[model samples]
Target chain A: MSQDTLFDKVWDLHKVSSLPGGSDQIFIGLHLIHEVTSPQAFGALKDKNLKVKFPERTVATVDHIVPTDNQSRPFKDNLAEQMIETLEKNCLEHKIRFFNIGSGNQGIVHVVAPELGLTQPGMSIACGDSHTSTHGAFGSIAFGIGTSQVRDVLATQTIAMNKLKVRQIWCDNKLSNGVYAKDLVLHIISKLGVKAGVGFAYEFSGPAIDELSMEERMTICNMSIEGGARCGYINPDEKTFSYIKNKLCAPKNEHWDKALTWWKSLKSNENSIYDDVIKLDASKVEPTVTWGITPGQSISINQQIPLLDDLAPNDKLVAKEAYEYMSFKPGQLIKDTPIDVCFIGSCTNGRISDLRVAAKVLKDKKVSKNVKAFVVPGSEKVATEAKQEGIDQIFKDSGFQWREPGCSMCLAMNSDKLIGNQVSASSSNRNFKGRQGSPSGRTLLMSPAMVAAAAINGKVSDVREFIN
Target chain B: MRSKFTPPIGKISNINGQCISLIGNDIDTDRIIPARFLKCVNFDSLGEYVFEDDRKTLKGKHPFDLEENKNSSILVVNSNFGCGSSREHAPQALIRWGIKAILGESFADIFYSNCIAIGIPCFTLPKNSIEEIQKYCHNQFLFLEIDLKKSLAKSKYLNFNLEIKESSRKMFLSGEWDATATLLANTSLVEKKFKELPYIQFCNDN
Candidate 1:
C-alpha cells in the first residue's frame, strides 16, 4: 500500500525474468571475484566452452591465497602458485582487470572496492566469497555466491534468487567509548540468537547506525551473513555519500547531488512496516568474544565461560562439546586463556582504522615472545594509507609483523596458518575449529585491539585493561 | 577414490508430531560441526559433532546428545536456519545426523541447496503457523502429513509453500540424488566426453 522500501525498489528494478522454480533472475550491477574461488569457476567455464558475458561488470583481485609476508613470485606453496596462475590466465583470457600482488591496488576484495570507490549505494553486488556482504555497508544489496553461482554470474551477469522479506534492526543511542561496531554486532547476534533473520533482509537503522563511519558500518553489515540474513544494508545517507565521494566509479560533482537526492529518496518511509523488527540499545554493548565454537556461543569479555548447568538441558550437550574442544573449564574466566598467536586482518576488521587502533595499543608495549603476531591490511589501498600514517612502522616497532594484504589466516586460504593446537586471538570472524588453516588450530574471535593486547600478553587479556 | 553417491538406507518415519521448536538465528555450519572435524571427507564420524557448541555433551554423553535426535528424522528449526558460509558439508553433516527433513521459517541459500543436493527435504512454514505448531506441540500432540509423491506437506502448524528447484525437487522426491540420475541418464556419454580431454589422454598415455 505504501511506497516500496529501498530493498523492494532495488529488487523490482533488477528483476529480469522469473522462472517457474519460484526464483527471479536478478541482474547483477557489480560482480567481484578473487583468486581462490574464481579459478575453479573460470575452469568450469572453459570446460563448458563459455566466456564471461560482460567483463566490465566483473572485477578481479587476488586474495584468499596470497601470502601476508614474503609474497615473492612463484610462491613456496605449489597450490597457492597454481591458484594465482590459473586466475591470471583466466583474467587474461577474459579481459577482466586483475589487481595482483604488489600492484599497489591488490588487497582483500571488500577493502579494494570501497577504496577505489567501486562500491556505491543502491547497487546489487555479488562475489564468490561469503563476506561479499561487506559491500552492503554502502547501502548496496550484496551477497556471496558459490562457485556455480559465480560461473552463472560470469556467463550471464545474473543469478537466480528469491526475494527476502525486510527486517528493520533499529539501534537507538550512541555507543560509548571502548565499544566498537564489532561489539555491537556481537551483542545483536547474541540477542537475536542464530536464526532470527531467516528469509529476511535486515535494514540496520537508528541514530547509532547513522553515526558510524563507513568502514565501521562495513564491519557491521559484513557479518550479516553470519546472522543468516540473505543480506543486510543501511539506507544511503550523507555518510554513505561522503564515503564514495570522488573515487573511481562514483558519479562526478554535478551527478553527485543528483545521486544523493535519488539515494536519499530510497530510504524506508516513516511507519513503513517490516516483516520483523528487532530493537537494541547501543550503550549496552561491550567488547565481545566467542567462548565456544560458534559465533552465537559468545559472551562479553568480562563474563566467564557458561557452565553446562547454566544452559537449557538441550543446549548442555553442545556446551560440553565446546568445553571439550576448546579445552576450557566451565565457569573459568575466558579472559585468562593463553594465546599462542594473534592475527589482525580479514574483510571484517582489517581496515586502516583497525590497524591504527592496534598500533595505538602497541605504541610503546612489546608483544610476548611466545606469541606470533602479524598485521595484514584488508587491501593494498589500506596498506598504502597505513604506510602514509606510519602505522606499519608503529606495528613493526611493537613486534607485529607487517604483511601483504589478503584473506590471511581468516579461513587460512593463504600461506598464513597455525601449526597445530595453538590457540590464537584473531580479529577475523568465525572461530571454528581448524578454521585458521591448521587441522587442530584454535581461534578466539575478538577485536583488533583485543588481539593486540593478547599478542602482548600471550593470553586472552582484556583490551580495556591496557587501554590507558 | 571415485566413490559413487549412495542414498542413505533408513526407514521412512512420519514425524507427524508437534514441532520441537529450535529458536536462534544465524546458525552457522561451523557451529553445526566446527571446522576441525571437516578434514574427514566422509561424514560418518563428524555427525556426532552436530551442534557441538550448543549441544556440548556430544563427546561424552553420546546418546544424550542432541545428535541422539538422530533417531527422529524430522528436525524443526527456527528462522534463518543454516546461515553463514557456503559449505556443502553443513547439510551433508545434517543428513548424516539422520535429518531427513527440516522445517524452518527460512534457510541460507547455499545451505538450502546443499540440503536439496543430498536427499533432505527442507520445507518452510509461515511464522504464525510455526508458532502455532510450537504452541500445539507444547499443549497437545500434533504431527505433520508428508507425501513425497504429492510433493506437499500438511500440518496444523504449517501450510505455507516450500519451493524447490525443478531438477532438484524431482531428484529429491524420487530419491535419485545420488548416482541414480547419472547412472540412469548416461555414463557412456560422460566417458566419451572424458576421452576427448587431453588430461585424460595424458593419464592413459602415462
Candidate 2:
C-alpha cells in the first residue's frame, strides 16, 4: 500500500460516517462562531428547542458589528445593538462562551482563537466565516461553514462534509531580505491563478515554510480563501508545537507530549502522493499588490496593467470591467494610482508582526495630509504587545489612528467606512468594489508596509523608498 | 415538529430551453452580489443587484437585467461558483432574484450550504455535463425537472442528485422553516438538559 498523505490520514481518523449522498460526516474538534452569522442558527435551535450538544467545543466573539471606536452599551446603530443582544441571549441560552467588546479576549474571530490558544494542532476547526482557514496554520483542517451548518454543529458535534483532495505546494529557496510570507503567498496565488486551488486543500511545505514563524504562517494561510482554496495549511513542526505549548487550550505536561506526537503524525508521509503539486521559488517573490478587482489581478509594484488588446478574450472582458469599475486608464502604471485612506488591520495582515513592520516604516514620519491612515491590531493580545513595544505610540505619532482591536474597517460592518469614492491603500485581503463600505469606494490591496508608504505619500508609491 | 418538513413554498420550475452561459472561475460572493446591498434586512429586491458591475454594461440585454427574467430564477454559472466571502446575503440575494435553482460545475463550500438551506436546488453537474447543458440551452428551452419527492432533478441534457442534509432537504421540500424541524430532532435531549440546569443557579453563580 502507498504511504498515506496527511490529508488521507487525517480524513481516515476523523471520519464519523458516510452519508447516503457519498459525503463523509467528519467530526469537528472545535467550532468558532461570531455575532453576524450565528443568530439565525441559534434561532433555528430555539425553534427546535435544541441545546448546544457541546457548548465547551464552541467559542464565540463579536467582531463584525462592534464599532472600532466608542463601543458603549446601546450602540448608535440599532442593528448592531440587536445583533450583539441576540448573540448574547443565544450564547447565554445555549451556555456557549462569548467574548464581547472590551473583553480582553475580544478581537477578530480568527485572531482571538489562535492568540488565546483555543486553536490547536491536529484539530479540525470550523467557523461561520471564510477566513477560518487562518487556523490551518497550526496544521489543522479548518473550514468556513454556513449558518445551517452552524445549527448542525450546535445540534451535533459532527458536520456532514465531503472529503477534499490535498494539493501539496512545495516552496524551496530562502526568502531574500525584505521578502515576507505575505509576498510568498501572493506570488504563489498569482502563479497558480485564483481558481487553481478549487476542490483541494493546500498543504504548504518547503524549507521556507519551515523557517516561517507561526504568526507568518498564519498570515499565509489567512488568505487561502482568496486563492479559491477552502483551506491552506502547513504541517505542524517544532515551531507549531512551541507556539501552542503555552496556549490556554493546549494540553498540559504529559498530555502535551502526547498531543505533540499526534500533531507530528499529521504531516504527510515523505512519499505521499498529492492530487497536484506546485513548486515556488521564495527568492523570486516580491511584495505584491492588486491593481484590479480580483485577488489574482495583481502584479509587482513596478508592473503595469496589461493592455486590453493583449489579454485573452475572457480575461479581456474582466480587464475591461475592472478598468471601468476602477475608473482607471487602460495602460496606467499601478504605481501612480492615488489613494485616500490607509488601513493596516484585518485577519489578513493585522497582527503584532504586521504592526511592528508598519511602525518601522512610519517611525519619525508623518502620513501625508491628503491621506488618512490608521492601524487596528487583530487581537487584544496583539494590541498589548504592540503597546508594550511602543508601536502604538509610533503609529499615533505618525498621524495614524491607533484604534482598539476588532475587525475595524476590513469589511466596514461598523462605523469605519470610506466616505465616498476615495481609494484606499489597504492591507486587508479583498479589493472588491465597495468592499470597504461606500458603494463607490475603491480599495487597493497591499502589504502593511506598502500601505504605510502610501499613507506617507498619498499615492501608490513604493515602500522600498522608506525601507531604510 | 414533524420528522420531514417541506422545502420553501415558492412556485418551482425548471430552466426554460433558452439561456445564456457565463463561464468564469472563482466567481466570488462580492461579484455575485456586492456588499453594499447587504445593508437591507429583507432580500426581496436584491435580484437586480446580482453581478451589478457585469450587468451595468448589458443594462437592457442581460437576461438578469430583463424585466421578464426578473422572476425567471434559474441561474446558469460556471465551476467553483460563489467562492470567497461567506456572506449569507449572497444566496439570499440570489433567492430573491427569483432563482429557483442553480446549475453549475461546483459551488463554494458556504454558498452551497446556504443554497440548500433556503430551498434553492443547487444542481451540480459534471463540468462536461454543464457544457452539454450550455449547448442545449443555446437553441431550445432547457427544461429541467425538479422533483423533491425523489430528491432528484433532471433536464433533457442533464440529471443530478442534490446532496443536502437529510433534515434540511425535508425542510426545503416541505416549505417549512428549520426552527421546528431542528427542535424535533433532539427534543428529548434538549428537555433533559434544560431540566438538569437549575433556573436559579445563573443569578447565584456570578
Residue by residue across B35-119, what tens digits does model 1's lDDT show?
4454331344545566664555335543215332334555666566676776555676665655667877677766775565456
Error of 1 at B181 (Å): 19
DockQ, all models: 0.10, 0.22
Instruction: Give candidate 1 misplaced runs (Cα > 4 Å).
Output: A1-3, A312-314, B1-83, B87-107, B114-149, B152-206
TM-score of 2: 0.86
TM-scores for the candidates: 0.78, 0.86
Candidate 2 C-alpha lDDT tens digits along B59-113: 6676566544443445777767887888777886666655667778777767876
Clashes of each: 24, 18
Q: Write the per-residue lDDT of candidate 1 for residues A317-433, one digit (tens) a residue.
A: 556767887888999988878999999999999999899888988998999999899999998888889999999999998898998888888887666889878898999978765
